[model samples]
Target: MNHPIAQRVPGRRPAAARRPGRRPAPRPAARRLAPLALLCALASLATGCGIRATSVPVDAGAAPSRVGCVLPEDRERPDGDGADSIVRLYLVCGSRVSPVEREVRMPDGRSATERLPVARELLEELQRQPGAMEDTAGFETAVPNDLKVSGSRDGDPDEALRLNRSLDALPPFALAQLVCTLADTAAADADEGVVLGGPADDEAAGPLRRYECDTALRTHPEAAETAGTDV
Candidate 1:
């Protein structure tokens, strides 16, 4: 049956309808990793081609050591009674004069005039013969027994002691002994070396002279020849 609207031409068919083309299926996971595996193998081959392993030497010895130590022993002490009241006086030992320490009994009085008495006592002690111990030790005195010493009140700066005899007539050693002993006594009274003058009757004598106790005078009494003399 033919209808006007549904009629088809004899040589040509109706325009064919379009259809979508099919996409390929995904491959297995292991099969997809094959390219990466081949790349890693090539890298390993490149690195290992020329490289070699190496080794170094080491020392094996013993260490060092040390020594031991030691210690010391103990000692004893000495006595010190009656040391504070002692005073020193120069005495002749052999040809040389040296100081000897002895005990002094200070008076109950404390006035400045008390120094003269102390000095007189010291001079008396000096004139006395040395005791048995001192004699045995070769210590003696050169101070004359009769020579007297008196304090000066003449307002003279150069006179501390007045002697009973001419200073020039005394032996060098005797003068040295007297000078040193007086010097020490003067020091006890906080005074400098003592100044001495000849007998009061010697108005014509030279000026008073000052004297000191020193190491050189002790070692060589002859050195006193120029010391304590008027210039």
Candidate 2:
């Protein structure tokens, strides 16, 4: 027996259905993981380990140094005691020589002929420890307590000052302090600086040397020993 054919409907779409045994295609593994990878990269950029990233070079000057070169008080002059006079003593601060005011019983004279007395007094003041205020302000004296000063010998220059210790034996800063302090006082020629000699009795006493407390010495006290001129 023959079967009859079904007739088609004009301008009408047929209904679609999925096969029972088939499944839809799965998404690509790379496409699904791409968003997660991008998120991780962004997080790493935002939170660096410690330092920040910069394309431009930055300049921060030299590292900070010890001891601020500041004076603690406004004591430029001494109290009006009849016996005491105000004087400047060069002290080491921040590895440089700085002037500090002090009061001492000036040894009764100011003439060039009486330079030794003034020199001795000044040397003693340098050897003395810095006062409370001076110490707090980073002022320190390198001159030794045992160091002695005397008038120049017979053949020595009239303006020369003698030291018990050889000039080479003293520390550079100590030499610098002495030179700078004396240069500003009656003990030395203010323009020519100070002339120093070793002990009169020492066999190895070298020729007198003139040490200037110029801007160079004040700034770089370590060069004090080499900054002298043979007088």
Candidate 1 lDDT over 1-231, as tens digits, reads: 765785676876665532447467789888988986777667768784344533654454655532111111231212224533455677888767877666665443434566567677778878878765567567788888898877664565533567777777677788888778767553233554767777766786556777777787877897776777452
Q: Can you write out model 2's per-residue Cα lDDT over 1-231, one digit (the tens) per residue?
A: 777754556765443433566777878999988997777677768775345579797788887866765675565557748988888889999879999878788866667865888888899899889887788788888899998998888888789998999998989999999999888677886475799989988869888899888899999999987899998
TM-score of each: 0.57, 0.69
The number of clashing residue pairs in each candidate reads 0, 0
Model 1 spans > 4 angstroms off: 1-84, 108-112, 153-155, 187-191, 229-231
Error of 1 at 150 (Å): 1.0
Provide the lDDT at 34 for model 2.
96
C-alpha lDDT of candidate 2 relative to the true structure: 0.84
- Span of 10 residues, lowest total lDDT, candidate 1: 66-75
List residue ranges in candidate 2 displaced over 4 A. Answer: 1-66, 74-77, 190-192
Which candidate should be chosen as best, given TM-score against the real structure? Answer: 2
Backbone clash pairs for candidate 1 read none
